[model samples]
Target: MTKAEETRTRIIQQAADLFNQQGYAGASMSDIMAATGLKKGGIYNHFASKDELAIAAFDFALEQVQKRYVRAVKGKRGSIARLKAIIYTFATAPDEVTVKGGCPLLNTAVESDDAHPVLRERAQRGMYQWRRMVHKVVQSGIDSGELQPTVNPDTVATILIATLEGSLMLTQLYGDRIHLQRAEQHLEQYVDSLQHVDNLKQQESSSR
Candidate 1:
């Protein structure tokens, strides 16, 4: 890539980590300048304003998170396996791969709730995308008769997202992985329970 493109990408990468750690409002222009080793004029040369930069950084952070989720479920067949993989991803994310501070969706949602409209909207869209991914997996399970036909994909999605995000918050707050580990165990069991009774019986019979 050209120098200009490379520079812009570097700035976004630095700012994404900074904002994810310090938050949008908490992270001043000087902080970004320090993090990126660029002066005001140099940073502004790429991003028109702090608002613009914040949006770009958030998008970058969200993309990183989305990629993790995609990788978590990659080549995994069946809805239960995919969903469990997602939970495993979240549970192990603190040490595996993450945006430095924490889950961008959770961080942005909490920080931008009443202050930053643009960021709040971005977080909303990101959340929708994540929920939709989970929903599709659950729906596919139902279609394949692996999951109970009566299960609602939307509900399952909400439960998984809420539980995982909430557990992440606790884990971040206390600096302990037990909260996330417990949530992971619970979610795995929950996903297993979604399996169709007939499928469970068939597996039981096959084992005998």
Candidate 2:
């Protein structure tokens, strides 16, 4: 990439980290400039304003999440395994291990929904993508004969997305690990229900 493009990407990455840490309202253009060691005119040359930068930063963050987290479950067998892997990934994310900032989408959703519609639209798109990922997992389970025939992928996916986001919010606000753990517990239960009782024992034993 060109030197200017590389600098722009560095600016976006720094902005995303700050936005995830401080939310849309709290992280200013100056904060981004400070993080990237750029002056006001330099930042404005790449992004028109803080709002525009926020939208791009959020997109960059979500792109990372989709590549790292959502892609893990793609084309995997057994909906239960797919969902479990997803939860496992979130519970053991690279950034989560080193930093305290939780899900970027949730951070933006809570802060931007009523305040910044541009950012909110980006956040909402992210949430829909999240819900779609879960939906695909559930639907695959049914197609593969791992889940009950009557299960609704759309509904189940919606519940999982809402619960996951809410739990993460609480985990951040209360600074407690249990909220995230319990949310994963619920996800586990959902996965368990997808497995056939008759095949579960066989499924459990085959690898061992």
Candidate 3:
């Protein structure tokens, strides 16, 4: 990459972490400058304003989290395994570990509410895309006969996202990992409950 491109990426990454830890309004240009070690002119050269930088930073953070999800689910077979992988991944994702805050999407969603229209829309879009991804996996499982035919992919996706995000908030609030762990276990059970009868029976028998 060109030096300018590298600098831009570096600014985004640093600003992303800053925004995640400190809300959009809470983070100032000086804070960003500190994080990126760039002067005002240098920052403006890459981004027109704090608003533009925020959008780019949020995108970078969301993309980083998405990449982590992809890595966690990679090579896993079956929709059930892949779905569970997502839950497991969020429970202990690398980005979360490094950020020491929480899910960037969730953070942005909460902080940007009724404010920062562009950033808010970006978070909303990320959520819709996530719901679609989960819905696709659930539908695929049904099609493959791995899950019950009556299962509603949309409902399952909504529940999974809600439960996971809720748990994450509680986990961060209480500084307790158990909240996330419990959510993971419950989500796993929810997925297991959708398994076909024969698959469920086989799992039951194998455990014995």
Candidate 4:
């Protein structure tokens, strides 16, 4: 990439990190400048205002999260496996990775819900994307005969997404990992319930 593009990307990366560490209101131009070693003018060359930067940084951070989830489930054959992979990654991934600053979607939702309209919209889009991903997986599971045909994709997706996010929030707030683990356990049970008995038996036996 060109030097200009590299500069823009660097700024975005730094901003994403800072925004994750510090909420939108808590992060500052000076903090970004210090973190990136870019002058105010140089930063302004890439982004106009803190609001713009916040929105971009939020989008950037959220995109990273989406990319991570997608990569985690990529090449996993069944939609149930894919869904399980996602929660497993989130539930059991090393503390160093998922612990810091909590989930980006949850962070943005909490911080920007009332104050920042643009960030709020971006957060909503991120949530919608996640719900849609879950919905797709549930629908595919039904189509592939992996799950019961009577399951409601949209409702199931919404609840799963909400429960995951809520669990993360509580875990982060309480400084306890058990919340995450419990969420994963319950979600796995829910997913297992959707499976046919033979498939479920095979999965359990395979785990043995």
Candidate 5:
């Protein structure tokens, strides 16, 4: 890539981490400038304004998180497996793979609620995509008869997202991974509970 393109990318990456760690109001232009090691003018040349940069950084952070989810479910067959893989991804993501502060969706949602219209919209879109992903997986399970036909994919998606994101907040608040671990365990059981009776029996028989 050209120098300009590379520089812009670098700025976004740095700003993403900064904004993720510090909320929109908390993250100042000087902070971003310091993080990117660029002067105010240099940064302004790339981004029209702080709001613009914040949006771009948030997008970048959300993309990294989405990519993690995608990679986590790769090669995992069946809805239960895929969903568990997603939970596992959130539980085990390393510092490099994860946004520096925490879940971007959770952070942005809390920080931007009714405060920043653009960012609130972006977070809402990101959350919708995430929910859709989970909904699709749950629906697939129901279609394949691995999950009970009566199960509601929308409900499952809501539960999964709520449980995971809430647990994530607790994890970050306490600086302990145990909260996430507990969430993983609970979600595994919850996912298992969604399994169709025949699917459970098949597993039981295979184990014998």
Candidate 6:
């Protein structure tokens, strides 16, 4: 990457973490300056205004989350396994990626819902993408004869996403890991239960 591009990326990364840790209104120019170690002019040279920077930072955070989820499911052939992997990944995201802030989508969605149109739309898109991924896995399982044919992918995906996001919010608010762990366990069970009886039996026997 060019020097300017590299600088811009650095600013975005730092600002993303700051915004995720502190709401859009809470984070100030000084916070960005401290996080990026950039003067006001340097930061503005990359972003036209604070609003623009915040939008870019939020997008960056969302992209990081998407990439982590993708990596978690990589090389998993079975839809159940892939979906469970995603649940676990989200349930216990690494501190580096989480950046002491937890899920960026949830943070941004709740904080920006009423005030920031661009950020709210970005969070909405992130949620849609998540639902789509879950739906794809459920539909693929049905097509492969691995899951129950009667399962509704839309309903399953919606419930799974809602439950998981709600779990994250509770976990963050209460500073307890049990909520997250319980969500992960329940999600894993939900995914496993979606499998056909024969598949479940085979998996059970194989575990012996």
| Number of the top TM-score candidate | 1
Query: At residue 45, what lDDT does model 5 achieve?
Result: 88
For residues 42-156, write the lDDT of model 3, one tens digit per residue: 9999999999998998888888778887887789899999999989888776335645357888898888867688988999999988898899889999999899999999999
**Candidate 2 residue-wise lDDT, 51-132, digit = tens:** 8888888898888877866567767667787888888777556335322266888787778866788888888888888888
Show where candidate 2 strays beyond 4 Å.
Answer: 94-100, 201-208
With a 3 Å backbone cut-off (N, CA, C), the pairs that clash in candidate 6 are none
- In candidate 5, list every pair of residues with a backbone clash: none
Backbone clash pairs in model 5 (N, Cα, C under 3 Å; residues 3+ apart or in different chains), count: 0
Point to the candidate with the largest lDDT: 1
Error of 4 at 156 (Å): 1.8
- Residue-level lDDT of model 6, residues 131-166, one tens digit each, is 999999999999998999989999998888888889
* Worst 10-residue lDDT window, candidate 3: 93-102
lDDT of 5 by residue, 1-208 (tens): 9999999999999999999999888999889988999999999989999999999999999999999889889999999999999989887864445678888999999999666999999999999999999999999999999999999999998999999999889988888889889999999999999999999999999999
- Per-residue C-alpha lDDT of model 1 across residues 25-123, encoded as one tens digit per residue: 999999999999999999999999999999999999999989998988999988988999999998898897557899989999999966699999999
Q: Candidate 5, TM-score vs. the true structure? A: 0.97
Query: What's the TM for model 1?
Result: 0.98
Regions more than 4 Å wrong, model 4: 93-100, 197-208
Q: Give the alpha-carbon lDDT of every model.
A: 0.94, 0.79, 0.88, 0.82, 0.92, 0.88
Query: Could you estimate the TM-score for every candidate?
Result: 0.98, 0.88, 0.93, 0.89, 0.97, 0.93
Q: On residues 1-208, what C-alpha lDDT tens digit does candidate 4 reach at each position?
A: 9998899888888888788878889888889899899999999998888888877777777877777788889999987888898888777643536324668888888888667888888888998998899899989988887888888889888768877888888887898888888999999888878886667777889999
Q: Worst 10-residue stretch by lDDT in candidate 6?
A: 91-100
Q: Give the Å shift of residue 14 in candidate 1.
A: 0.6
Whichever of 2 and 5 has more lDDT, that candidate is 5
lDDT score at residue 163, model 1, on the 0-100 scale:
97
lDDT for model 5, please.
0.92
